[model samples]
Target: MATAGNISFIPLTFILSGIPELGNNQNWFAFPLGALYVIALVGNVTILFLINREDSLHQPMYFLLSMLAFTDIGVSLTTLPTMLSIFWFNYTQIYLQSCLTQMYFLHTFAAMESGVLVAMAVDRLIAICDPLRYAAILTNSVIAKMGLLILLRGLCVVFPVPFLTRRFPFCKTHMLVHSYCLHQDVIRLACADTTVNSIYGLVAVLLTKGIDSLFIIISYGMIFRAVLRIKANEARLKAFSTCISHICAVLVFYVPLIGLSVVHRFGKHASALLPVFMADIYLLVPPVINPVIYSIKTKQIRAKVIKLFRRREIGARDNVIATI
Candidate 1:
């Protein structure tokens, strides 16, 4: 069986665009993969631009959403272009070192995303459970600190993968079977003992994604308890409405990701397309639908977006009148 994956040909070129080249030897996939990456890039950048520009979007929730969007940009930039080249062009040459580095960042961002979801859940729990202290608790400085903490923690978790794998000598058959830079896929290509590396990667999954997921569940469970206890009918309705968007985002992210990981690990014989499709959904769906979810559920954001669009329309009308 031939590996459909492409290895990075120009190892250092990844530094230029933050997109590691899958097969420097194969530029044939530059079009399709480049196009999808360009879409992901534009979409995520637009999200960041909106969050930064809108003063109303400077809340804890939107701040975290912006971070998620920023991470999406990072993940997409780090991988899809390379993966696309491999999938489309059948480029299968990657240096041992570059492959390990790609695996590190890929997992790093995945862990950070898990932690960010936890942070967002905590933010929601606070806002819902305690209204008066929300301002003092989740300030801008605090939010920044939380973001930094998540980044640092996730890096600590994922950094060990590459360091451990790179220590091993890779087997001559360096081809990877999957579409992307996966830790297991890369390390399995090593000729040296990989038991320790595989164990370490498993520990990473349990600690970072597993533990963080538990915390998020606990936070939301508490939130559910609080929501149920509220006495005012209209207030309760409003609270549930605010949570609807977050609930949707949480399901969108956790479901596809957990499914992909579960199927990839357990059903190794399953078609690679299952995990690949799940990853695509996990990475792409949240950013595209997140803003839509929030806009529909959050009154203030909906109003602000409407106001911005109306202003653009009025400006265009004025320009047309002037031309006439």
Candidate 2:
């Protein structure tokens, strides 16, 4: 325990509550969570490998996709160990440093994901509206730089969060509402004035998620305008069709995030499990579903995936026949 400015901080640890309202039934909750973790891990890894192997996927679009996949994996892996421990082994306690570290990675990757989505939108806008300059605009060097910039931007903006929280004395109960640590859920435990923390959080969310969404929407708006100028309906449809997967990705990523934010801010009177459920979906759904959506929507990726699976199946069959 430490004292600062007449405020006392005690028990510098947090107890993570994994669907505590569910009580003893929290064990049952582990099944779905484990499934999500597996799916997210497998799905994002497959996307990365597929993009790396397939020559056809060497374009700027797929490059941005690989970045997204990496960030998705980061988001899931950040919380998986602690979350599983809490759900299955009843290990709810997490040290202050561990909790802050988890929060940093989770939020950083989330911001990076948002940035990648914006990059993808811009890629589509250029491909659709200015096809001639697409290659020149988003060359390999530019793509690499963009990826680095996105990562650095996330790091710079999120780096101060843990430090800011560390300044205040956490005299209040340190029981987090969800399986994972979040800025909002963790900051309230502080005994000091959290106005700075709250204001910074709001600013960070607006700058990353809010601004990225606005740009994405505007990019699509420009894309639609460009598509409308095409005389041939088929060409317009083809151009618009390329954006479906991105649109789905954006929806899956933003809808839940926004919904969860809204619920947190206004739905305080709602069921305890409701916010936790939304948080789970917000964190878990994008990584697991993004790859599935892309694989299904993009014909090239789907064919490659099917071909890869068939090859494995054939190899197994050949081994059986050899044994016979």
C-alpha local distance difference test of each model:
0.72, 0.90
31-113 per-residue lDDT for model 2 (tens digits): 88899899999988988998999899898999998999999999999989888998888888998898889999999999999
State the displacement of the C-alpha of residue 161, model 1, in Å, after optimal TM-score superposition.
1.3
- Give the top-scoring candidate (lDDT): 2
Q: Local error of candidate 2 at 212, Å?
A: 0.9
Angstrom error of the Cα, residue 150, model 1: value is 0.9
Every model's TM-score: 0.81, 0.96
lDDT of 1 at 299: 78
Best by TM-score: 2
For residues 1-324, write the lDDT of model 1, one tens digit per residue: 222244332232111111234335445545655666676676567667778998878888889988887777777866765566565655545555566677788788878878888888888889999989999999999999999999998888887777776565543555555556677666656666788987887898899888988998898899888988989989888887777877887888789878877876797787655666666676656656666676677677677668767998999999999999
Q: Give RMSD (Å) of candidate 2 vs. truth.
A: 1.8
The count of backbone overlaps in candidate 2 is: 0
